[model samples]
Target: MSEDSPPGLDLARLRTHLDAERPGLVTGELRARVIEGGRSNLTYVVEDGTHRWVVRRPPLGHVLPTAHDMRREHTVISALGPTPVPVPATLLLCTDESVLGAPFYVMDHVEGTPYRQRDQLVPLGADRTRRIAESMVDTLAELHAVDHRAVGLAEFGRPDGFLERQLRRWGKQLDASRSRDLPGVDRLRERLAARLPPSPPPTVVHGDYRLDNLLVAGDDTITAVLDWEMSTVGDPLTDIALLIAYTEGEALGDDLSSVASAPGFPPVADLVARYTATSGRDTSAMGWYLGFAFFKLAVILEGIYYRFNQGKTVGEGFDRIGASVAPLVARGNAVLEED
Candidate 1:
């Protein structure tokens, strides 16, 4: 192991375990570096000077209950591999904590770019950018159209009362990480609880869906849909609504990482229309879903803020994250009022 390996990953132990579990996988001395951009899970790019792979695990500390489940992420990706959904080929799921002090999994390294900011899309021009964004929406529709039962994911999640459980779960997460007062947060939660929209037939839900979560190839194709820590079988509309929130929300500010604001990226209404046309799902109750999406993002950012304050977060770009929480709460209330 190199002396400068990132936190929460011991290369020596990792290589030893890999050699024992899957012999001859590592050919040479193993080297690894942290892959940034993910806020909840810690991703690392490991290499043996011949082959490259990606590793995923829970954050360093202050992990909330039932959050960042490595087994769930691995299972979903593995299940969706045979489907049209693009996911890395899973190599191994390590549950033995003695190896890494936390459960982790490894998969083949995919080559693509996760465009975060609008400027990053500018170089691609409007036509290419539009094609990539539309492909993103289409990919999401394809995912919602998948038969969870056919993919052997019938027992993946409880869809009976998904919305109510999601609201309560995120509320509990906020309470667990409450370190500072947030205005309008209570009002937002109450409003959401008061007006629960009847969910359409449940489908696989990617709890966090956005452009940055997708890796795009040079041909404007979505190579893979990454980040499944919050994924499960739930209302499909929740997925699209969350995508809308990430695209249109003002909480993160203009300079923050939002490729949706780039030129030629479809607007919220256009994206919604495309999804409706493709998935044949009714979007009449999208207003309420959008409100809930903002609330969920606010709670997520607040949790990150708490972890950052405690010096538990491992990456950069977290300093301005705390300020985005109040704005997100405000946006949630505003969306509900407009609805």
Candidate 2:
């Protein structure tokens, strides 16, 4: 191991595994730096001076089973390799924990920018920003249009009761992550339960689809749709709803923390119209879907807050996360009422 390997990865053990698994993969000493913007998984950029690749693994400890499964992430991304959906080329998957204290996979690292904030997109100018945002929605439509069974992902998830299970699942997660009493969270959950929408035929769903999750090239094209930790073959509307909810959060100015409200980005309505027109799915019940999205995000933030309280999260930017959960709950309530 290098004398200064990052917290989540061990360079020495990684090098040994790479050498044995694929000869000549590493030409010299390996160095790594953790990539930010991902709250659930730890992403690292590894290099041997000349060659570079990206590595992904679960968080440090207290991981939810099924939530951060590296095998699942690797499998779905590999399945989509032949499709129109852009994904990094999967290189290796190391399941043996002895290699890096956890399972991880490495993929070809493509060069592009992940615009997490509006300031980053502002430099690209309004027209370019609009193109990137529109492209993001269109790419999501393309992903939702994929044939899951033909692509060998038919058993990825149960589509029959997907929304129902999702509602119940996030409620339990919220209860488990309770650092303080969230006033409107339960009401939002109950509202979602009272008005569950029947899902359209299932397709591959990117559980968290948004602008920042993609790598945009200088030409305003999305090079890859990263982060498949929450992906599955389920209700595709969940993807669309989540995408809109992100832009809504941006509009709320509550540190929903995405480039969804950037000056040049297309309106969320345009995104919805494009997806509905392309996918031909009924968005009449989108209010329900949007509510579910807000609930899901609120629960996700609460989980992060829980980790921050336990001192399990690494690095900066976590202190303000706990404060965002309540507003998300309120937003969820509003969207549910709109439904």
RMSD of each: 1.2, 1.3
lDDT of 1 by residue, 1-339 (tens): 347678999998998899999999999988888998788899999999999999998988999999999999999999999999998999999999888889999999998999888889989989998898889899999999999999989999999988999999999999999998898898899889989888888788888988888889888878899999999999999999998988875336742356776789888899999999999999999999999999999899999989999999999888888988888888888888898
- Give the distance in Å from residue 223's predicted Cα in candidate 2 to where it truly belongs: 0.4
lDDT of 2 at 222: 90
Tens-digit per-residue lDDT, 1-339, candidate 2: 468898888888888899999999899889999887677789999999999999999888767646788998999999999999999999999899888888999999988888878889888888998888888888998998899999999899889899998888888888878868899888899888988878889999999998778998988889999999999888888999988888877655445655865787777788889888887888888888888898999999889888878877766688888887788889889877676
User: Ten consecutive residues with minimal summed lDDT in candidate 2?
Assistant: 249-258
In model 2, the runs with Cα more than 4 Å from the true position are 251-255
- For model 1, what is the alpha-carbon lDDT of residue 39? 85
lDDT (0-100) at residue 10 of candidate 1? 93
Candidate 2 residue pairs that clash: 1-12
Positional deviation of residue 30's Cα in model 2 after best superposition, in angstroms: 0.3
lDDT of 2 at 207: 97
